[model samples]
Target: MLGEFDVGGQQALLDAHALVIGLGGLGSPVALYLAAAGVGELTLVDHDTVDLTNLQRQIVHDHASLDRPKVESAAARINALNPDTRVTTITGRLEGSELDEAVAAADVVLDGTDNFASRYAINAAGIAAKTPLVSGAAIRLEGQVTVIDPRREDAPCYRCLYGDAGDEALNCAENGVAAPLVGIVGSVQAMEAMKIIADVGETLAGYVLYLDAKRMEWRKLKLNRDPDWPPRGGGGGPGAGLGGAGRGWIELDKYNRVKKPKHPWV
Candidate 1:
């Protein structure tokens, strides 16, 4: 099993707690893989119900689970896969203190959510909790995955990448998504989380992975902390920026920070 790869890694995964937000397309594969891999505890949060359309990409739910709350559907599937994994389900959207409490209780948080507002909220909570975040997104045959570790001084949080970009809702309901694209992104997210928790392999703390499914190509981009971004663990307070960079006002460098792919296939 996992012990052959990393000594005592199986027990390490069994001792970890993970909090997952959203149980849709990306979440489906993330939750399934984590449970199958022996994560000790899981906190699942999702407000939506299983709809007929979700079956296209949400593999955790089936026709039997139609109209059921997504958390319940996902929990059932997880239990069926691994009864040893304990699951705590929250069936509604979490905000404010609730989100903070959940993030604080977990060793790692995974964001399978679809919108910017939810991502921003999760980022703020992860920063306050000093927890690592594994984030994934998929829509219209494209996907992206990134790991945000607030504990790292140079690692960029989600806000640093999309400052002031109001939540422009883009989802599979409105934009068509490839059936297997979410699986690819979500599986990658789960793998990153496992590596972080087990303290094995090189984590993607400062890199964002971009997937172009249509062309079957992948790109990796380096991320930088926004100079004006609030200090980590400061609870949104102002402090000396990373590298002692002045913080009156700084322009976001997301557009210029992305490194073009040298080789199309990796």
Candidate 2:
């Protein structure tokens, strides 16, 4: 049924492991989908316990999950979805050395955490560990998802976008979010994660997908590695596309169109 995925791709998912940070809005669907997709192992991390308020978009949890650690609750759902998946729960702030170790252990990392500091830390750890990070966030009526893979030469890290800009984004707790916005973002995150693990198809590798639910619009913003990134290297980095041959930052719309065909009987 999936022409893009062959036996090798399914096997790749079974042999891969993904580390998911945060088990709230974004993490909920990310974990569930990854498990259902047959990711071999998952390491779930979150320090918070499920609250009744989380039920709205944190679809992985239920009324019975209240007061339970988010990692535990999400694991329960993952297990029910696929009993073969190896689930590991870490109910603590995964930072410093612990975060580094976790990222190093997995084939890919999914970042669903909402705050800047946490995102920055996860980005640095993923870069250090040379693992891919599939990051997603939803707040208010908008959401965005991107893949930051240091392992992909010249690919940007999460810090490249926000290191200088700083994050003005507020958490869902401090703001109101449309119930399904996180679902859309999280599903995309999961899709990107599976692509990285299975090594199939083009991913959101060098682009960030932004969704504006108000107008129901989606935008793919090109990403450039920070000029000052890696700090010591000159501003120039690896060129976009394969083998540094691509012109920097191409506009996909121009190349991906087909003119209406001429009618023979016209």
Candidate 3:
């Protein structure tokens, strides 16, 4: 399996560093594939515990992981799949200085988080560290993926994309999601992460890809940087208040309109 990928670049990933912010649906596959791809170091941060419902899409956990910290469950799976990759588990929420420290050491940060608050923190940290971020989300049969490079002047940061965090958001518990949707997007995240580290292929830095399982259709949207967006600071600037200002952040309600066009996807 490893041979099919760039073998010469294996060391790049093996020596490369990554951080996954959540261990739920999308996080599971993203972490698993990166580990399997031999990413040298991976840090997983999540405060949630595993529940039976997670098994539907969070394939990293099994019957044994129920009631266990999600980070531990994911770490064990990654280490078992690829002993070469170093796995670190942060068994709680990452915020403020701690979140900054975790993201500062990574070459890429995967936005597997489900909420806006965490997403905003990851975005600020990635921008501060000038690291690339691979963001993915899946709800129902739909998924989206985008890459944000804060170091690049033309590419927008996460906050530039979303307007704000506190308007109204759906927790996964309230909103339903499809089982395989996250899998598909998360695997794509792993691929995009490798390409970014290797400096190969067309990365999803300036575009967003949306997938609909019910229709089995895919759509690519062009994203342009918002010139008026403010830098990372929790203030009242055009972009300051928004969650993922420069990076590609989705407005769930807006997305649902185009992604579902009928019933709610999530």
Candidate 4:
């Protein structure tokens, strides 16, 4: 076993609560490992259900779970893996007060949902709660992972990276993806979330870990802080995380609503 984490870290994991949004490919590995690692409680959220096509990478569900809500399928898997880990399931998207309440209750939040809409809303919720967020995405042969910690002023939030990229975030359904790609990214996400729960190691905050499966290589790219976001001071309070109007796009309209993701995300 790695010595970087000890009994105290193990205990920290046992006491930690992790909220995982999306019960699909990325969420599959994240939920399984978090439970296996002994995270005390987990809140699983997904508006979709399992389908025959999902078994490729959505390893949490099998044929028997098809037609079942993703959260329920994943919770069952998590319970089977670690009976002591308490699991809660939410059948739909978390928005407004519901979103904030969920993020506030968790020690860390994991974003495995596809689409910029869900990502942006989750980002805002994480920032508002000052919670650590571990986000992962995979499509085709590529994947990306990052940490946005509102607790750290210098760390960049989700909007900082994709604000100018517009509201478009691609998904596996629209674009073909290799089955194993999500597994790699999801595993890294699980590791990062566990590290946060255990209070060990430096997280990917301010850096995006990109993987190219075709080339089997990884690049850690630094994320620059947006000068206008979180509105410098009393304008939106310190670290409001989504306030500034620098990009010509309206933040209020964007954060206030989450469009349905192009694909069913886990």
Candidate 5:
């Protein structure tokens, strides 16, 4: 497949490390595909355990895996699928130095997390580490996916599109996502991550793909970087201007420093 696709620019997929920051719906497909595609290392992070509710969209977990840590279930499935891939499981929510350290060690990061706070934290880590991020989200009939590359000065980061508004996030638990919505978005995220690792084709670094499953329509929108947003590892300080809205600029470590509302969804 690599030879036919001319992927990785002579860099083998067997040497790449990918960090997936959730093991729920979106993370399920991303993890499975990356492992199947022969990514050498996968660092799976999630604080939640599998529930019967997650079986609707989270294909990585099954009846026997109920009540198990999502990372454990995901790792088991990945191992069963591809023994060549090494899986590292972090069983809890990663924050502070732990999150940054994981991102720093990875060749790429995939944001399958549900909330804005986690997304912001992951984006910050990716920027600081100069790693590419494949971000995906799904709620109800709507889904969106984008690629954020901190190495590209002109590319818009995740925060550039959605500021630090954790409270505003509508998760599947609340909004009730369609079963296949996450599958579609997560598959796209995996494709994007593989493209980045393989050095093949154009990535969605500056654009967001929106999927409206109800209407079965798709739209792509170009995103612009927020000028007031601080550079990678640059201090933005609390309350710094963030884009057009009155949203305050939160620092990279905001997730660790602040106490946030506990959302039920992963």
Candidate 6:
């Protein structure tokens, strides 16, 4: 099997290192496909556990894994599928110095997390590390995907399309999400990650692909390179998206207080 990938010119993918955040709907498919595609090293980050409801969309976690940490469960599945692919599990949020280190080590970072804070953190880290970050988001029937290569002079980042944490919308927990919707986005994320690592295919660096499952339509949202933004920088404090504004904190806290028992996706 290893020989098959090596001889087929897929050796680059097999030797590639990727970091995947969140082990839910999007992360599940991204992780599974990347591992099966023979990525050499994969790091799965998620602090949440497998709730019974997650089984609907988080296909990586089975009924038996209910109540187990999502990252651990997802890593076990990846190991079962492809032992040649090394899996590392980080059982917490990616923040502070820890976030910087993870991004620095990854050849490509895949964003499957559902929250704005985590997404922004990964975006800044991608810029700091100058690694390509493939990001995707899905809720209800809508999905979007983008690849950000900070090293590319023409690439647009996650913040360029949407502001930082300011006025960020609710995630799947509050609004609910469809199962297959994330699958579509995750598959695209996996594709972009592969292209970024193999240095082939036209990557989605400056554009966002939006999918509407109900209508079965695909929209490509183009983003221009913002020269005004930092061409080289670290952290989301000053010139970051939304200018370091985080108005979502208050509503997020309130929502957590009410839905803490019902939903545990964080």
Give the alpha carbon lDDT tens digit for every residue of 1-266 in model 3: 34535676776877899988888888899998898877899989888899999898898899999999999999888878998888888987666788788888899999887766666667778888888999887765677888888778777665555646454555555677888888898899989999988777688887777787889998877666666655553433334212334343344344531121121111
Q: Taking the tens digit of each residue's C-alpha lDDT, what string does model 5 give over 196-243?
A: 987888999877777878899998866667667666433342332233
Which clashing pairs does model 5 show?
Answer: 8-198, 140-177
- Kindly list the per-residue Cα lDDT of model 1 for residues 45-156, writing each as its tens digit: 9988999999988999999999999999999999999999999999887888888999999999999877656777788889888999998877777788889998887778
Q: Where is model 6 more than 4 Å wrong at Cα?
A: 1-8, 231-266
Report lDDT per candidate: 0.78, 0.76, 0.75, 0.79, 0.78, 0.75
Model 6 poorest ten-residue lDDT run: 255-264
What is residue 98's positional error in candidate 1, in angstroms? 0.7
Summarize candidate 2's per-residue lDDT along 1-266 as a digit string, tens digits: 48666788888999999999989888999999999999999999988899999999999999999999999999988888999999999888875788889989999999888765677677778888888899887777888888888877878766555442223344567667888998999999999998888777889977878788989999887766654556412123333321223333232212111111121100
Worst 10-residue lDDT window, candidate 1: 257-266
Estimate, for each residue in 11-55, the C-alpha lDDT of model 4 and write its tens digit: 889999999999888999999989998899999999988999999
TM-score of each: 0.86, 0.85, 0.87, 0.87, 0.86, 0.84
Candidate 2 Cα errors over 4 Å, as ranges? 165-167, 231-266
Error of 3 at 26 (Å): 0.5
lDDT of 6 by residue, 24-64 (tens): 89999999999988899999998889999899999899999
- Note the clash tally of each candidate: 0, 0, 17, 3, 2, 0
Model 4, runs deviating above 4 Å: 167-169, 231-266
